[model samples]
Target: MIHPLDKAPEQGEAGLLKRLLRAGLPVAPTVAVALEEEFLRLANLQEQIGLLFQGVFGARIDEERLFYAAERAESLVRESYLLPERAEAFLGSLKGWQGPFLVRDSGRSPFAQARTPQEALFALKRLYASRYRVEEVLERWPRLFPTLDLVLVQEAGAPQEDPGLSLKAAELLGQPARVEAWEGRVVRVILD
Candidate 1:
């Protein structure tokens, strides 16, 4: 049987993919680009699998290769984009080949729910930063924040009278005067 990696790149993507998987290569950039399309060419998809596996294995390529590659790919796809800032860090640490192979998820937010006025305000601020204006989020889901409720708890550390973002947030929300000051920058209003 021909080793998957040894197959010619042109055997179309299917044959090439089979070869690559059998050979245990990492993911390919071509595959990454194709991921946008609804359907994928198997050969190209195999390429991406190879590239991801390569990144995870680092220098110790041969030992425990399949196990490490699978774990790395899963972690990258699952958590990377959600917390983009930590994505690179996570990748870098994996390359060094130290520490536990798996990191457990401890499901607990210090402030569980946005019950209190302060919690509600913080939630809204984070929503604006991470979820609201993010291009991908908006592109994928258009009517995301049509009915948002913003409640101000304490004044965000903006200039006293200026109220920097607080006012702007209200305008963006299309509910300015509806904004009510609770404590500081926190205010409560429903998105109507």
Candidate 2:
């Protein structure tokens, strides 16, 4: 089956990332698992949580109690199996990729950081589990739950040569900032 990330734009940040790459930006290559798949995983996880807790607490558990239960259930998410084909495709895409990777959330207020493959996989599981975290739930309580469907698996970019540029930019902007430089060229300006 064609994984959603294989297509452009429609698969969320994958499209934007591709466009950036084509435009000669310094972003590394990435692969992603679609939102639909994540939705299914989340739904299944919720069902499993219900089953596991129903006998002990019954179905009338309040949101606070449910949040606790969800935290406990997070460990199970690491064991949730990925489809063999999808796993193969994801791994295959990074066959010869060297250095560390980055597993990032592709949603509003996205965060990105570097990791090895094993670390990235663990992070991915945690990212999924984070959907039900107490703080996350509180943040999205009004929305019921915010969308957290996409994962960005990208090769780690080279380290900044003069990280002082970030400090300088922050000083000038009167806010935190990061400078992403590659091949002696300043590629990105991130403000915080």
Q: Which candidate is the best by lDDT?
A: 2
Give RMSD to native, each candidate. Answer: 23.1, 6.3
- For model 2 the local lDDT of residue 23 reads 51
Error of 1 at 153 (Å): 37
Per-model TM values vs. the true structure: 0.16, 0.63
Superposed by TM-score, candidate 2 places the C-alpha of residue 135 at a distance from the truth, in angstroms, of 0.5
Candidate 2 accuracy as lDDT: 0.55
Query: How many pairs in model 2 have backbone atoms within 3 A of each other, for residues 3 or more apart or on separate chains, i.e. clashes?
Result: 0
For model 2, how does the per-residue alpha-carbon lDDT over 7-31 read when each residue is reduced to its tens digit?
A: 5454444554444455554555556
Error of 1 at 77 (Å): 0.6
lDDT tens per residue, model 1, 1-192? 111122323333323323333443321211101111111122243355446445323445343654555554444333322233332332332243221121100111111233333343233224323322334223543332223211111212221222543455446544542222222322222223
Off by over 4 Å in 2: 1-7, 10-12, 35-43, 49-67, 107-115, 143-145, 157-192
